[model samples]
Target: MARKVYGISGMHCASCAAIIEKRLTAIEGVRHAEVNFATEKATVELDSRAPSLDSINDRLRPLGYLLLDETHDQGAAESETAHQATPKEREEAKELRKNRNTVRLALPSAILMVALMLYGMLFRPLPHTLYNPLAMILATIILFGPGRTFLRGVASFLRYGAATMDTLVGLGTATAYGYSAAITLFPPVRDFLGAGTHTYFDTTIIVIGFVLSGKYLESRSKTRTGETIEKLIGLQTKSALLVRDGKETLVDVSEVRRGSLLRVKPGAVIPVDGIIAAGDGTIDESAVSGEPVPVDKGPGDSVTGGTINRRGSFTFTAMQVGSKTMLSRIIAMVEEAQGSRAPIQNLADRVAAVFVPVVLVLALLDLLLWLTLGTRFMGFTEALPLALNSFIAILVIACPCALGLATPTAIIVGVGRGAENGILIRNAEALEKLAVADTVVFDKTGTVTTGRPAVTDIVALDTGTAASRILQLAASVERLSEHPLAGAIVEAAERDGTELLECSQFRSEEGLGVSALVEGREVRVRKPTAGESARPEAAALLEEGKTVAVLEREGRAIAILALADTIKENARSAVEALKRQGIQTVMITGDRAETAEHIAREAGIDTVISGVLPAGKAERIANLQQEGRTVAMVGDGINDAPALAVADAGIAMATGTDIAIAAAGVTILKGDVGKVPLAIGLSRATLRVVKRNLFWAFFYNILAIPLAGGAFYPIFGLLLHPALAGTAMAGSSLSVVASSLWLKRMKIG
Candidate 1:
């Protein structure tokens, strides 16, 4: 298997990541693909013999995804180049260059359009000499100058043995110009033939000008969609204060190597990924984690790159500098994601590929039918107008605007709605599958509980001390240790504001319990002693399922502090909601069976698969799929990666590590389980909209083609002019956009 990483652009949430994975997986020889919305990178494993980068790139472009690099090579090279640009300087220079180009093209195009309109309406009936010469000059500039891009696109399609909407417009306009030139150069030929005084130069110029204006508008709208990522990339600080030999010197963030000590001041963005070696302040991690709360940091806490330090001065050694920083990876991921394609976009592409050929055939049939009728009153010269009209009509009426808008427009609306609800959909396709999740498998520890242990009930064995008093002594002993369980016990004591007696020479045994000398007595907490029977009520409580942390003094049992994993406040409600949607909820955990059962019961989950390792979790997911269930795995730990990768769909919590996010298909930005249902609802809604859009796009062409081919002209004597054909084409494109915009207002369940 060959592994390649792509920095995807335009991934705003987890759904976007899913879309990329789905698209890449469809490629033959792609063994596996994983996309992380937060990181915005896709790691794809493929059989090198069946697929190539060129084919992948071609597939992604039409879906609006851009693959930044096939491997880490280009990103490493670019990081060195970016270090020299100074992020701020680079952004300003890029903006200036883009604005200059936009102004250069837009200004002249606007001027020529106005001049063409003025000449057509005001100077149309001038002497033939002036009219013909001026019209020729104006038409040439309008077609060749402002209209060059569309013409070039048309030419490219033809060169590739295909056709696009641009091909139709280019051909129709060029044909009009050809007819106009024929009339101008040989007026005597028309007079001798008694042909009507009709020339199409004005029509070609006006139509191409209007279409160009529309093209510009479409380009500007697309730019707006990408504005947020650009603003995000623009916020990075160009340089950081690097401390070397007791002197502080400014160096580019990319140039600050790992192991270099860096100084971060109040209100400055952290320039490199590093640990807080000496800081007593809070850092805003909202940009990276999507959390609104700022976390307090002290020595030994890891801080990510590109986050802002709100208050306090700190110096830290850089752990990950240059392109390895979280911010750089995110930027690269977003770039590649934007370039990734959706599966539905492929249908639009296939339809567009055949569109021009079908139109040409219909136009030919219309002309042949009219000729076979033997209407000699109008010669071939007189019949030419009808033929030209049919040709242009066929081209204009078959707009694939709705087909183009089907997936993207629905996704934009879905993502925006999801964001408002604290759910971020990373891509369009993920939203589609999420709407149909049949089974939701949750990781028990961090996913269900706050991932923290808490005191549930207490049991006293033989000692006369009350359970509360035993807990106080146990909490006192635990307060002197820094283990996770110790922290839990200490926090519980603090929460209850219980006075903790000082413990001397506390010794904590790994995987066991702590022992300490408290108040001139030796206190030890450990697992329950053999043959130590609990009181009747305490025994019943233990049987009802709770973890008992036993307390002892002088080798005799005192009391037991019962601990349990508490369910999140929203966990019950979220599970109930999933059940209402007919989804089966299961809990998978590496925790002991009793602990898993306790948590699962509290969360109201239907099934609990306990004592499972990462690989076992994956096996369970596969088993569910083998039984015909569409499974979605939700997790936040690195251990959950394999299971998440194997599930039909994987959802990683926002609190999850980079590896978990990289392995999963979706990343819940708010870390809210409720968003899982919301994502599912949005996916169903988006797919519905895609279906409707495609239906209208294809249906409109089916009905309009025959009418445009003059099917009703025999009875009504109605013929569509090339100008009206252009208008109808514009309307068809606009109709698709309008329908898609209407979807933005749709109420998603």
Candidate 2:
């Protein structure tokens, strides 16, 4: 299957989006389609040999909408430079002007309609010559001018069998105007009905007035939702100073090639992803990592594009430019994530799919039932106009716009909030999954404890050499190895400024240790097995949660080196937070029982599973699942990939291996253990908002539909006016949007 995103035009409400989504999904070879009303974009997944763009557009043209190609707006949409007006910005500006014009037209129509309704009901009715022509002129201008889009939508619906909110509004207003115009133009029709019966001129104009004003407010609020992406793009610097052979030349950031040295001064954003080649500086990486603290960057340290250098100057060799840069990748990830539909949204889509058709059927039945029964039970003079008013009110009030706006609006705001707090929620499903996970399993090495291990204990078995000399010899042999423990030993030696002898014929034993000829003596460093004559000091170190290595020279035990990893500062606090939320925390590791327990205890984990190999990790996660626990695994290495994939929600630290990140569902940008609970909290909060929005959207329609159908007339002697019904429909959609907007102010982190 292949997936693509296309810009859609002429979506007025959620019902319009639903119509497009349904039609697109019905196409042959198309697997799924999601149309987001707020974003005004449709994401479609289809077979490789699916329909062509022309065919897709052919299906949509009759629906009064257009699909724009991905590359159509090259300069505006795809440009990395952010200072220029983007395609989205241009669209928003145009919408603002259109809204102003709509309001200007709608206000006059509304005032005229109010005066006409009051004159007919409160006092004596005006003559047809005076009131009919004035109402006719105002209603026509409102319907054809500010309300032209709905008329076009209705025309498209008639031709293409497409039904939407626009169709309902247009049909309702047109019926009122057509009936009223007939009564005005022909004096016989007015006399045939009754002397007191007045034209329904106010209903036509007032409905259009409510719709235009509602659309203006909806458009403005929708524009604010895309500000997150705009702000992120704004962080990119437009130009950089390229350094070549001691000469610097200014160039666009996009023009900087990989491996080109770029000079960055203090107070300037890093132009691209690169490694520090010279000098040192403090870089503020909050834009990408959400870490407020400034990070120190020196030679060999990586600096991401869009980060600001706070102090000192530096020269960095660009490693990733353009779209491959870290900031660009983040923006792309967020866009895709925001566009994805959650499973919860399916319910709303399914409801919206049938909502418009059902509403149309009910509206027709309402008119037929009332006209047939009301004419005999009451009288034609009193019943016909009331039946007509009832039909118009039913059609105007039943809007699928609220249903369509329910989930996507909340998801967009929730996901955008997550991004703001250094949490990269991969998709809507992951966000939903994280909310319900009951158990969280942490990989010990890089998750609970800091992955970096340091030499904690050194013991000399015999008097062959001093402690410093023993460390030097061990470091010399270990330098040839790439294991984490080996690196620790090498680092300890370097930190102490110890002189190391050269090693030759270096060889490493898998899962055991390294061997080398150091100072012309065969030296070996290996983990002690069962019954090995390890010193009491080494055993003590192991008991204290340190990994001990036995070093021997010339068949004699010479020294022992013990290295231990320290727990993260925030791990315990994060675990405690999860516990408070009624979530169980477990630590899984391949370390010795004592070592694992020590780390787990420090991290406040309730359960510890130690001595588990790489393959056993997934099995352990599966066992937890069998126990009915919704597991969330957190890891940052290749070995943890299987476990990450097996769990309900896999959270990967951004600093970990690429495989780990690929296996995980969520990635914490700064690799902070505390973000684990933060992600879950945000998910739960977002889901709550989604449920609330869905509930209100459904409830609003259910209650409003019945009332608009004149269900309350028999008991309360009340009928919903078409103008009031239109106002209620507008309010329902705006209420859902407003509730979703509340998520932006939530304190997720």
Candidate 3:
């Protein structure tokens, strides 16, 4: 199945989101649909013959949803977002204004209602004709003023024959106000019905007031979750010094394009990803890679956007601009991850899909049972009052607001916190699964050991050829080959200040290594075969697990050169941390058994799967999965891509190649092996918050719904008031959002 993601608008609650998912999956070509209410986005799965996005969006418009073009937003992101504020920021400001309007009305009305109730208690109550009019004015002000949002929600949501939290709030308050108006203005109706002379103006006023107050608090918490994105967007450089034909002119950063030469001065952020064409600088790339040490970059070295130049100056040709830059992709990936659904959210979606309608049915039953049965025991007047209060309470208390907010709120806060710590989570599901991973498989090179190989030991066997001379000749010949070992040999010769002689007739074998003519002698550098491996010098080097190569001249071995990659400093401690957390650690390598075991032992990994080719790496991961293990593959090389995709969770170092990062579910910046344990720890912490939110929502509904329905009225003589029910319902949603926001206080990777 093919997948597509789109920003969504007009979703007010979980039921509103679930409604869209239902309608989209009902479409002919769409296979599955998931609409996340918190992030206001949809992830859809489609088949080979899926309808166009435009056609599908047309279907959704009638259902009160719009599929926004996120691709357009991303394309214009680096320019428009930097110069102007994002559309989401504008929406947040608008929402805050609306909340303020509700608060201004609700506060005064609440104070006036309390004053009137106190007046009635302290002295003789005003006559029905006078007091009822005062109450009517207050209720009217609260309902249509602060309650307009719910009224609008009712019109937009209920037209499609669906219901949400807004539907229940609007319908319950409307029912109380309308019924009170009829009884107050036309008293004959109440007398003829013989129920009561009292009007429910207080119920109408208090319910909307409490609900609006809860919304005000919720908006504040949500704003805190977006701070990370705001900080990241603010990091983009505003302007650049464009170098055109040897003349430099100041211009906006957005004007930068591919191949445009730009002069970056000391203490200025690089405008975009580019390569230095002239001069050099000390660049502080901590903003992009989270490595604090400034790196010395010279001509031909690449510099990323948003990085600060600490010293010197250089002119670089821009290679990537706008949304193609690194910062923009990170922002996009973070947004996508926050909008994604975890597997645990399936339960919440299934419940929310049918929650409001089920609550409506239960509320109707509550009214009918009280009116028919309770009227006989207590007569018409008293029972009628119980029936009305119970009916309204059931509607207000069982709104499903908290249930809808359970998972997505936690995911948003978790993803935002991860971004601040330089860990990028691609989707919510990865965080969930990685938290419970049983085994973590690490690629030996670049993950646990330093990928940069260095010459460890050089032994001269032929008395005439000195150790320095052997290295100089070998480095000269190997320099012609483009291999990691070749680079190590060249660097060793350069470090020792050895003068390398020129080589002729340079030729290379695939596995046997390079051969050339140096100083009129046939110089051959190759790995030892089975017979040659038995020699004293070769055997000693192989036992130590170094990459052993022989330098041969005139068909006689002159020297044995061994290269070894150093183990990462934190690798052993990282492995120990995983073990302490009840996770098994294994090493996967293409090296010989001796070499693989040496690196594994150094990294505190007891299990070493050696001699596995790149293609076979995925097979090993699949075999581990077949054994019922949740395996997480950690690597920083292109060969790890397939294995990373095949594992239960893929953790890639941002220092690695792009393909590895693209394939992995989680990417850690700074290339520190210690970050592996931190990533898993952060996932576990986030999952705990999600679970706590879900548990509270489910527990609140189960315990509160029956009490609001007056289930214990006969035995305990207890009935909850409609006003208190609305306040509790509002508090439930606020509590769930607050629980998610609490994730910010926890330590992140």
Candidate 4:
């Protein structure tokens, strides 16, 4: 299957997304469709032989929507997005202008209607021949000039059979305008219904004016939410000093290809990701890593694009240019993460899917109830006007905008903040899961320690050769192995100027030790395992809190190489932080029980599970989960891949193996264990924001919908006007968006 993201044009609410997703998924060859209302995009998975774009567009045209293929001339699309004003900016500007124009046209009519209402209340009503025609003319201008958009939307709904915010607005406003026009033209029909009846031309103008003002505010607020991505893109310099044919020439950043040598000056941003070929400089990589400190760079060090060369000038061979640069990848990842939907969003989507149709039904019922039964309670003369006002209010006030905006707005803000802090959350689901992890399982080496062990002690027994000879022989055999402990033994031998003899017939036991033929004798080094033959000397060294590797000659133990790895500076504090949050921290290692316990104690871990082979790590995680714990495994090695995959959330350190990073859900660059708690803290904050948004959205509807339906009119003599309903509905959506944007201000410690 092939997956692609297509830009959608007419997604106004979450219900529109549901309709698009349902329709797209129903097509042949399309496996799945995920439509995001916040991003206005649809990610679709389809078989190799996919349906035609025309077919997809044909299905959407009736709904007054467009699905743009993102894969067409990506270079052109990027250039169009970056060089010129973005599509979003253009659309928002257009909306703002349109809203301002509508307000300009509607304000005069609204003023006239208010003056007419006040004149009637204070003095005798104006004659229908004079004031009624004036009101009808003003209303016609307002309806056609400022309210034409809603009218066009209604036309689409009638022709296409799709309902949206436009459907509700167009129906409500058209009803008020049409009723008033009838009352003005046919006075006898109005007199038969009620003697003191008046046309509602003011309501039509006020409703459109208020709804336009809300949309203008909403468009402005949404534009601010995209500043994170904008700032990131702005860091890339448009031009670069390209060194071609041994002569320097300034060229567009896009013109610089891979293998091109680019000269970066002090204070200038690097044009592309590359290796330093000549000169050295202090590079400020705060834009990419979020670390404010400048880093020293020398020849052969890799430099990323968009980082400023703070102090000296350098020439670099561009390795990854254009979209392949690290900066581009980061932007793309952030975009994907922001567009993703969490499991919690499913409830919001389900509610939004049926919200419009249900609101329509409720509005109809409100009108029917008032028309039939309202006369008995209120009076026959007031029933028609009350029912008309209630129907209009119910239609205009009941909006699904808040419900659709709740989840995606929060997710977009959360993902952008995480990217700025050097945490690349893969998806919304991973960030959501991180908030619930209670048990944190860590790999002992590289994760909790420095991962670089030194040979601290070497003890020789049985007068065969000097301790130096034992070290040389052990180093010779261990040099063939790539383990960290093996490097420690070899480094010790090399420091002592011991000549190592070549080893042959080498064999390594996974988690146990290694054996090889050194100097025509069988030499073996092993960390003692349970139920395995061991020496008393090895036990003594193990009890001393050292990683002991015993050497044997002809299957007899001879010497012990005791190594110790230094604990990381932040390991203890990271463990303490987790413990303070009531999270249990466990260290799983392949070393002996005594060594594992010692390291655990030094790192402030409460539990130590030791003597487990590399392959059995996942089993240990499963056993822990059996005790009803949500386990999050942090590891930085190939051996930890299985355990990482088995845990509820796998956090991979950037210093770790490629397989471990691939298996993990969250990857923390620079391998800082302290960031684990920070990720959790950020997740909790984002989850809190999401919950608050959902609750407020539901609560607003629950309270506003009933009031709009005139549920309190019988007892309180109150009725929510359609204009106020429009204002309240607009405020509800704006409030949800404002709440989501507030996540950026959170300081996750």
For lDDT, the strongest prediction is 2
- Per-residue accuracy of model 4 over 22-104 as CA lDDT, tens digit each: 88998888999999887777899989767887888898887767777655245533322234454444554665787777777
Order by lDDT, highest first: 2, 3, 4, 1
Q: Model 4, 262: alpha-carbon shift in Å? A: 2.9
What lDDT is reached at residue 192 by model 1?
A: 66
lDDT of each: 0.68, 0.85, 0.84, 0.83
TM-score of model number 4: 0.83
Model 3 per-residue lDDT tens digits across residues 587-651: 99998998888888878896999999999999999999999999999998999999999999999
Error of 2 at 672 (Å): 1.1
Of candidate 1, the 10-residue stretch with the lowest lDDT total is 80-89
> Which candidate do you rate higher for TM-score, 1 or 2?
2
User: Per-prediction TM-score, please?
Assistant: 0.77, 0.88, 0.86, 0.83
Residue 635's lDDT within candidate 2 is: 97
Clashes of 1: 27
Q: Point out where model 4 deviates above 4 Å.
A: 72-100, 103-132, 244-246, 454-563
Best-to-worst order by TM-score is 2, 3, 4, 1
Question: lDDT tens digits, residues 1-749, model 1?
Answer: 77777666533222334446667888888888866432345778878564666688676655445555534344344342243333323433454454455445544544564575577578865455666667677778777876564475467556643455666677777877777777788888767655565666666666665565454444344344344345446546678899989898997665678898999999988887888888666899777655578888878988877788998888998898766776665555444444344577666645654566676677667767665552474676667677667766676555555455555554555554454344544555555666667999999777887777787776666556775677789889988778666677778878888888988988888767889998989999776644543655456556646656678898877676776667877899889878877889999988777667877888899999988877788899999999999898999898899888888778888677878888876777646776676666666776777678778777877877877777777779877765556566656555555555554467654
Query: In angstroms, how far off is 253's CA in candidate 1?
Result: 0.7
Cα-based lDDT at residue 389, candidate 3: 86
Cα RMSDs, all models: 7.0, 4.8, 4.6, 6.7
TM-score pick, better of 1 and 4: 4
